[model samples]
Target: MDMATTESTASTMSLASVTLEVADPEATHRFLTAFGVETYVRLRASQAPSTGFRGFTLALTVSRPATVDGFLDAAVNAGATVLKAAAKTLWGYGGVVQAPDGTIWKVATSAKKDTGPATREIDEVVLLLGVEDMKAGKQFYVDRGLPVAKSFGGKYTEFAAGDSSPVKLALYKRRGLAKDVGVPAEGAGSHRIVLGSTAESFTDPDGFAWEASTSSARP
Candidate 1:
């Protein structure tokens, strides 16, 4: 069977894989921050003209609060920067960490009301991107051959959840994402993030980088 046929059982518009470019592919790949996310790091120099967020957050939804706290501590000890400490809120327990590769990870537990029990390591992750125009962004992705699993009120959108892989994807307004991290609406000169696919390389409406490749699989 062809690649599409193999991935058909996965979610619609599902990602074949996600790749991150770092100075050291071996080191970064060993620096596993979460599971269910496939990564390939290669030695690449600065291609962007400026330094700002390329536009995405690696969001991890764990099964329990302990997993949230444990992953936070483990990540920090592994050299990740603590952007936010785990706290109790309507969204359960969650915190943010900036991994060495400059990727922002939002780790959260949906226990709501309580920290819940300690749990195992993370085994699921979903990619969340920021777009300047939700309407236009949605249209852009939809036109790019990604099936829309859900798009509502222009506030949030998600691609078909890839069935075999736990690495799902979604998008939100860039401004809101910046605000969420207490950053400016517009970042500095260039972007730092690149989203990979199995076909071709292109830039999204907000300038996020995406390159097409041969095949994508969960590791």
Candidate 2:
């Protein structure tokens, strides 16, 4: 590879972590622990004014329908309000819940039926941001060095990340995403979530903030 190409590849940004800014960090931590995703995201206290939808949803993909139930039940029991009950769909079975701290979570599985008993195993964790413009959002991430892993016309886009990366990042249309998660598309103020990346800090076109990976590691 040429020197410039080598340097660019070496510095390509990767999602390192996700921090959910909440009102009560301790309570949110306890809730996450009960919901079996404490390690997937960190929490911090931020009283930023926000209302309606936060323009994003964090998703958990599991092995089977049963696993989806396990997560949904756990989250609901741990102070989450059910937005959508677990049900079978053309693609799979899934459900949506909003945590007490205002974060939306969706648990889903591609398998139509369970081959075994449910477990706490999670196959993937995805952070999906709802943006005003799909093409613009896709281009913004592309310009920042996030290679496209998958694209569905102008409706959705997913970015490639290292195998060890804690979270996968994706973009979707705001109104469509809100419909899928059972919320309204109108929201203002802070997104109340921060992304940690290997690249330098910058805000996306939709106002999603990214920070140096080290800052997210702080306690």
Candidate 3:
């Protein structure tokens, strides 16, 4: 991949992070840490602390604060459910939201700014597919001419397509992935996963559907 580029008038944006709720927070943290996030901080007490993500912070607490209520209202207006409300805590204010497909989001706010780095608005969407047969799916993508990045045994694999902006296309398989996304194992039919980009869809051998696209850039 070409890594060199000259700064131009056209603004460039890239994906910052894709947060997901897991059944086990500790395990999720460990997986992400091993997957390449350089730092991790567990929110605990009432004092606000800095998280590594830019423009975002995390706190641990029970009820919804006014600020969190406003945030929830915005999200609700946009069609999301308030899974949990933010409230004062030993650490700070925290809340949870349920996005489409049962995806849970943990939202927190703190007085400290831990803005780490400028994030590129997502250029592409990567759909991670969990399959009953990893080898077959891997071969399917390989035979289709998608570029393979790395394979963690037959358990995990990532691929890249030509539709590059910043985010690359990839797939992976793990136990309970389908359940986490609120889809049945047999319900992995072809469908679209929109991400403010060009829309593209693919169906793997195990009937698992994946989609990607580019849309309007985030402000």
Candidate 4:
């Protein structure tokens, strides 16, 4: 690694937890619990004005196609709207769902077929943020001491999710991300999401806020 990368790696920040600000914490919490992902996200009551796409998504990566279907089915049964039905694609089988609180979630798996019975074992959880300028966004995180784990030019960037973090971090173009989740690219007002990390509180260029990991909020 070069001087800059070395510096970033040395001070890399770990995303501890993701908190979703919703109008009804009780309802959202219920949905999350029923969906079997209450442990992956925290919830807080907030009436912040927001409309249309939130420019972010929480993704779940499992081990098999059956696991993907299991999550999708549970999410839908718990009041999540299906944005995309689970189906096999070039890369894998996946689907998208919108929670009642307006959070988009994508469940996927690399395995094309099921090897055994369906399981709720989640391999990874990733937080994908959509930004207006990919280069600027990537630099913003890097400047904040987030080392890049993977980068596909300006198309996508994944940050190293330290073992301590609850979820991985990544960046994508605003429109592209919105389209991938089957939502309009346009949105306004608060992002309705908060990132908990060891870093000081600050807002990113895309308006995603990060708070010092002092709050009682835990998955």
Candidate 5:
């Protein structure tokens, strides 16, 4: 295959962290720590914390079906709510889980053809945002120097992240997203997601905040 661009030549947005506004940072901390998000926490600021499904996550792409099942099992033990049991899909084997903070996670094995044991659990993650306007939401990131890898008729769009990103990002229609999370569509606030960046902190069109990882950390 012809290499049009490398991760370097592709995009400039490499995520520094995936922040969530939550009801209990302590509970979130414990749940993520079990799954290996070494530095998850809540904000200690004059402003109150945000909670509920501001968005969700396209968590990891495992190597096999059993891996997805096993990882979800671990997530269940770690105070997660099973939104969907692991199973085979036209895309591949996948499932959904609600983290302690109500962050929905869609886990799948994209490399289903590869009959391998499995990669380490939670190898790669993608931040999935449910946007009121998918077109406007996608343009928001495109204007920020990020490129779109895939877009499906303003329904779903995936961004090609820079190499420094621990996980990629995507956007989906808010109503469709509620279905994916296996919950009724409800709640909106200042947004729980805080984008970890090296540049100046800001907010997205949907009110999600972006913070420089270094300056982002607060007690």
Candidate 6:
């Protein structure tokens, strides 16, 4: 599918996929599957020292066996510790070694035999923001045509423009939020985090960055 144009709004685009860093392949795979992600693409086999797997795909593609070995070697050389060796799954795709960095890369062939129109629901993106002044930031969005839906203490706030699907803009205190989410707090200035939906961002008065969009998945 074509990427969303630059000027499109949140309603015009949807979240396609998210790549996460993980430590274990088997455990991660099992966990995601239990959480309702059954589709997967194995990029390597369980026997190999280094490998990866693709949990979900937006578009189907043919799998190449050579790509698997090359990916493993490249990952090892690049300093990734292998958690699980590459191996083929019973479902028909190859999965490779899991990386210590918590990132799993899978290469696999599409199981669907027929070519047809793509049909799937896209996810909303969520931004975790760190702000210096919560009250002021909340007021800015309220004045700019966004409405607050929820407030947690004086430190966190959620705002949104009306729509059928849930899309929100939020604000939170920097240090406290950082500690809660396990991310280092940004001092100031813009920090860009890209996603599959329309490009958007929020800036606190202190210049801290906040993601703005509905392409994030919460589990």
| Cα lDDT of model 2 by residue, 1-219, tens digit | 112111122327878889999999999999999999998898878999999888999999999999999999999999999999999988899999999999999999999999999999999999999988888898777777887777777678888766546789989889999999898899999899999878899999899999988884423
* Model 4 spans > 4 angstroms off: 1-8
Any runs in candidate 3 off by more than 4 Å, and if so which? Answer: 1-77, 82-113, 116-120, 164-167, 179-203, 208-219
What are the runs in model 5 whose C-alpha is more than 4 Å off? Answer: 1-14, 23-26, 39-52, 111-119
lDDT accuracy of residue 128 in candidate 3 = 56
C-alpha TM-scores of all predictions? 0.78, 0.93, 0.39, 0.94, 0.80, 0.35
- Compared with the true structure, all predictions reach lDDT values of 0.65, 0.87, 0.40, 0.88, 0.68, 0.40
Please report the candidate that would top lDDT against the real structure.
4
Q: What is the Cα-based TM-score of model 6?
A: 0.35
Q: Determine which window of 10 residues in candidate 6 has minimal summed lDDT.
A: 52-61
Q: What is the C-alpha lDDT profile of model 4 across 64-97, one tens digit per residue?
A: 9999999999999999999988999989999999
lDDT over C-alpha atoms for residue 211 of model 6: 43
lDDT of 6 by residue, 1-219 (tens): 233222212233222223232444455455444322224212111222222222111111233433443445555555444443444444433333323433333333323232443223212323445566777876665554454656766677665534432333456676765544233444332132222223355444644333444545332
RMSD of each: 6.7, 5.2, 15.8, 3.2, 4.4, 15.8
Candidate whose TM-score is highest: 4
Stretches of candidate 1 above 4 Å error? 1-13, 33-50, 113-117, 121-123, 163-165, 215-219
Weakest 10 consecutive residues of candidate 5 by summed lDDT: 1-10
lDDT of 1 at 80: 81
Please give the distance, in angstroms, between residue 29's alpha carbon in candidate 6 and its true position after superposition.
Answer: 18
Candidate 1 lDDT, 2-70, residue by residue in tens = 122111122224465566655555555556634223342223434445456656777888877777877
Better of 1 and 6 by lDDT: 1
